[model samples]
Target chain A: MEPLTVPGMLPALEEIGRYVMAAAAEAGLDKRASYRLRLAVDEIATNIVVYGYQPSGTEGDIIVSSTIDDHVLKIALEDTGPEFDPRQHAMPDEDELTRPLEDRQMGGLGVYLAFEGVDDFHYERVDGRNRNIFVVNRPSAAPAT
Target chain B: MDVNIRSIDDITVVAIEGALDAATAPIAQQQLLPLATAGCRILLDLTGVPYMSSAGLRMLLSTYRQLSGKDGRIVLVGVAEEIQDTMSVTGFINFFTLRATPEEGIAALKG
Candidate 1:
């Protein structure tokens, strides 16, 4: 069990994304799955940077945990800044793409895309922390194209 | 991020060279918004853009929506194949215009 604690800022997002990607690949996750994992991790990290904590101080942080068994990559993100439930938000409308720009809305598209990209996603606020856990991977024995 | 600005057929052309992911995305949004409001035909040459993320999508889509509201134009030029695949996966292929190059994007914006 390895863990990383970030102060919950936008710049740190890519750092954590890279870390997750490297760990996922080392654990034998597929290439496509790894990119999807990056996207999911970015979404969650951005959420923490934006809504997880107040701007005045640095008491809040995001903690990421990883566990690899065989080829499975299970990742968890827990933040103690604020109580946020991304799962409760509705998915963005993909059809909004072709709509004239005037018809499109400005926010929430990433969360929906993140939700659609991952396999198993869960969100929970447990004992004063917002915990998000998701799994991404493919079998190590899967043939490489 | 590398930006190359040029002019062709009376349109201001900007070529972005890099991955428009979580890190470099705000730059894309910030730079493109000014071009959008300038109200001339604008072409974003993404031929050099190898990849784009949700942050980048939000910028593009949000700018597209804002420009369309003002009856302005934004054209897509040189979107890479890999980006097209990501766009399709996220259903953005159906949302924004996909162009082969800057000239074609300018033509499409005019139409």
Candidate 2:
């Protein structure tokens, strides 16, 4: 599928999600896998828009592209906003996740869940843009299109 | 996202329709947070919510924190399977009572 370029803003998240869903559908991902991919993409895209772009007081576009193979489906999000790596962010530990609501820390849960939901996640700074790659293994029974 | 609030006996039924994600979470928060008062019972009807991201989870956590130790109760009804799985992974599912339907959720809140 063709790559989607959406403005890195809060309102553009819905468009980003639609692009991801379309890619997932093209890959013939099942409901569970599709939802996971969508969540993973949504989380990182939000971070790019909210933390990376909005805070910098500059506007940018998030470039989302996907590729499907017999083995896995890969989605990549590229943004030219400030260089930020989600992997470097501190995720909630097991204790934090299990802690009572009042005792749990609020930040990082989204990033944590985003990476954890996918089969594999990778971050790289290619040239000047930050690229986040998410991989979800296609089920064996799913026919290759 | 659309948030509709109605009173059922003493419980406030907040029905949210549409995807509950970062784009729409603030709207849900704006409408739902004000209903979290001391000793308030809230039944969140999510039958129309086809998808939810961590933003929605954060809103739920915030609401839960507000009601904690205040004798307030909150229940979730008609949670989609995918949303439930996301909540389970984040451990947010354990924080609230889940029911299959609004009737069950209202009963859970009352009981």
Candidate 3:
């Protein structure tokens, strides 16, 4: 699918989701896989906009591009914001996840869910750009369109 | 996201009719949090929501926290399968009462 470049802001999240969903549909992903892919991308993109760009007091654009191979669909989100690696962030442990509602902390839940929702998540810094990649395997029985 | 709020015999039924993600979560929070006052009973109808990211989960947790000690209660109805999986992954699913329909949700909240 063609890369989608949108401003790194909150309002652009919906557009990002739309781009991911379209890519998923093209890949013939099932509803569950499609939703998970969208959720994973949305979570990381949200983090990029809210924590990466908003905190730095700078504005940039998020470039979302997708590629579908025979066995997998990979989506990459590239942004020029500060060097923020989602893998470096600590995910909530079992104890933290099982905490009572009143005591539950909201900090890392999104990042954790984003990584957990996808089949594979990778983070890298290439030439000063943060590239977070999410992959979901296409079902073997899914017929090619 | 469109949040519709109504009362069914002291149970505030809020039906959300759109994707609940980062962009729309704040809007949902603005409309749903205020209804978490003391002794409030809420029935959240999520039938119209086809997708929900972690931002939606955070908003739901925030609402649950607000109603924790205030004797308020909340029940979720018509949660989609995908959203339920996400909620289960985050452990947020254990905090709320889940019902299959609005009638069941209202009954659960009332009981």
Candidate 4:
């Protein structure tokens, strides 16, 4: 599918999600995989709008593209915002995961969930742009139990 | 996203429809968080919610914390399959009671 380029705004998230979900379904992803694919895209796209563009007071565009190769669907989000690598963020530690609800912090779980739902996540800075790539492997030919 | 608020007996049910992403989460927080002050039994009906990101999960956690502080209870009803898996994987599943339907959730919270 052709890549989609949209302004880095909160409302643009749903557009990106729709495109990704369609691509995932076309690639023969199951319901579980399809849901995670859209969610991971939502997480990254949101960061671009909120952290990357919003804070800088500069307008930017988020370019989303998808491809399916060998039953693996890869979605890449390239943004014109600052250089941010989501893969570098620390995963929630044992304490963060095990802490009681009251003591638990409110943030950080988005990044964690973004990574958790995908088989692999990649990040890179190219030409002064932030590119975050997420990969989801299609279910095997074998039927799900 | 559209939030439909209703009350069944003493339980407050918030039914959210649409994707609960960053843009829409604040709307939910604004309407649902205030209910925490009442510290009454709450049921989050996600049947209409087709998708949820981490922002949605955080909202649920914060709401759970608020209710827990007041010794009140919150249950999630009609949770989408994907949302349920996300909660289970994030360990958020243990924090609140989840039921397959609104009736079940209300029964659990009221019991």
Model 2 TM: 0.97
Which residue runs of candidate 1 sit more than 4 Å off their true CA positions?
A54-59, A93-100, A140-145, B21-23, B37-39, B48-51, B69-72, B80-82, B89-91, B101-111
Record all residue pairs in model 3 with backbone atoms less than 3 Å apart, i.e. clashing. Answer: none
> Candidates sorted by lDDT, descending order?
3, 2, 4, 1
Native interface contacts kept by each candidate, as a fraction: 0.40, 0.74, 0.86, 0.80
Worst 10 residues of 3 chain A by lDDT: A101-110
Task: Please give the lDDT score for candidate 3.
Answer: 0.90
- Span of 10 residues, lowest total lDDT, candidate 1 chain A: A97-106
lDDT of 1 at B101: 66
List, residue by residue over B1-111, the lDDT tens digit for candidate 2. Answer: 799999988999999999998989988988888899999999999999988989998889889888888888889999999999988887888888999999999888877
The TM-scores of all predictions, comma-separated, are: 0.80, 0.97, 0.96, 0.93
- The number of the candidate with the highest DockQ is 3
Q: Report the number of the highest-TM-score candidate.
A: 2
In model 2 chain B, the worst 10-residue window by lDDT is B87-96
lDDT of 1 by residue, A8-47 (tens): 7776776677678777776677666777777787787777
Model 2 residue runs over 4 Å out of place are none
Which parts of model 3 are misplaced by more than 4 Å? none
lDDT of 3 by residue, A1-145 (tens): 8899999998898899999999999889988889888988999999999989999999999999998888888999999999999988878899888888778777788788788778999999999899999999888876665
Ranking by DockQ: 3, 2, 4, 1
Instruction: Please report, in order, the local distance difference test score of every candidate based on alpha carbons.
Output: 0.73, 0.90, 0.90, 0.84
Residue A88 lDDT (model 1): 73
